[model samples]
Target: MSQYKPENPATEEEEPDTLLMQLRRKEGSWLDWAQACQTLLQRQKMTPQVIFEATGFEPIHQNQIVVGSQVYEGMAKAGASPAVLEYFGRKGSDILYELRILSPKDRVQVAELILNRNLNADDAHEIARAVKNYAQLRERPEGFGDHPGDAVAYQAWKTAQQTSDLQERTRAIGRAFQYVHSDGARQQIERLLSTVAASSSGGSQRKILPKLSVFRLEEDLPRLLPVVGSLPLSTAAWEQQITPEPEGPYHLIHSQGQQTWVALPAWSVIQSARDPVAIPIENRLLGTLLNQQIPPEEAQDPVLLVVDRAVRQWQSEGFFLIDRAGSLEVEWREDSGSVSLFGRVLMAVRPPRILDEVVAQDPWQLDE
Candidate 1:
């Protein structure tokens, strides 16, 4: 057995010795263990590895409990019901750990949902992801309300909207109905399911948009003419090479003589682009700006910047491509200045890498 003592024992009330005794004996509930581990780490300035070596608690377990305990505390602070609190106090550390991804208020709502539905760790994970993704959307879908159930239903509904298969759409709608709490939302989902069932019964097929496709800049051949020389090229030069086709589906254009293309969903902004172009981005600072938008696998690789030359009016919230002394760069500016405005950035695209696919296929293989 490893014997460990705190370097600077503060007050007797802290009871560092008592906490250590409890941990050593493996006494108390999981919540109590978590609280003790957190206190030891935060108040005693003890390293997790040291605590692990002494208490037989793995460092990864320590991390989960510490974070889970904090989330439980947040739930308590958010006015979680007594039954919900009591249920989590003894068990559900993994469920609480997943709730850490949500806000305090969201955590409470999700916790109650978990308790009511008797959901396990995997269900908690799915609910947390659904709620987080729904919260990030700029505009909430019409039928969905601001409830945990509504978030999950909205996710299912969105999936149903993007697929053309009747059976798949019906399954998605049924899933939405399973989680939907509000009567209005349930009714909407039922209507959608009915339509899908009717379509499956040899009725007029419901019209649904094609599933959103990921267009790789490297894989998809470029459609638009390439641009040369410094950016913010004269109006005549841009007009000569690129023409506005508002009715057309293709929008991606590439520079640097590279035949790269990115197909975007029918976004109004991309559709209305008079002069669209795609440029390879190498700036680290720009990458930092777009870090949230880029996937982790493609973080180190150069991203494709798709921009529309038609919209150049400066806005505080908008990012624009500019001609900075013969060099082209992307910047977020508060006000327009002498810097030439090349175009407004529509989106930053990360091309799929073959290396990622190769590694994913045989991740455990050793080098010969």
Candidate 2:
């Protein structure tokens, strides 16, 4: 018999965690897809004044500084560009954010993400009439990403458009246990199963680990992450509407009256949500998601004390997801940019980094 088992039972490679990780990362921004669309469209209809008002930044006039090629000090540079490095000799606040937003890279990212992943051709140009309706929605020059043949799905779809049948490409993707799953992934699965089995030993299972899950049993014991409430008003098709305006990038205070928008940092915003107590507040989002993976009533509490002050966003450039496995936790990657417009909800899935910090030093605190 061979000494090594498969990485994953499905395929015998290193492991499939990387792929799953990538997929998770991609989907991380999906919840915000609707909002991104909103952002792009609003740009056109929104005047410079509106932009200033919405983002709270005043425009600056000419005579910019040039300390170095990369550095610009003193007065602003020439021309009435859409953005100014400094306004009337005073470096404007939030201009740094706008520069990044207006960068070609940002446009490319949004374009690829939306066209490649977010929109379907019909929703895109799939239905001619649907295309007309979508056309009514403004798409800005800043948008990049999708061309006619850019997306893989779009590639296959366009072929299907010209061809008679598509039983081939869809069939190709079905190569399951034969081509997927790596060796390391299988070992991890084995270790997890063993651990779950060990945990299943009733009272003997250590409380520090909670009860482990063996496929279905794990979901039953709670501790899997919850998804709380969802914002989609309807489970229907092709209708657009906006409600709930933007608030400041405040710390999403679970406390009352504190609900008003405040000029808080991104780190503060993320950190506040990490608080286990905030779970009840976040139950709408996290709880709903968790309920799908694990049962709602049965899930164990995280027993974490979220650190309010020490909390911070990563360079004001990212988001995190916390994947709970009863006791064991997993952190997922996300790329949520900084910019907390009012009224919009900052959706969180998993954030083990923030959660880990909060969970340290036994939160139970001996019945004070």
- Each candidate structure's TM-score, on Cα atoms with residue i matched to residue i, is 0.55, 0.13
Once fitted onto the true fold, the runs of candidate 1 whose alpha carbons sit more than 4 angstroms away are 1-18, 211-368
**Model 1 lDDT per residue over 67-96, tens place:** 787887777777999999889887898899
Q: Give residue 286's error in model 2 in angstroms.
A: 2.9
- Report lDDT per candidate: 0.73, 0.28
Off by over 4 Å in 2: 1-284, 287-292, 299-308, 315-333, 340-368
Model 1 vs. true fold: TM: 0.55
For model 1, what is the alpha-carbon lDDT of residue 295?
52
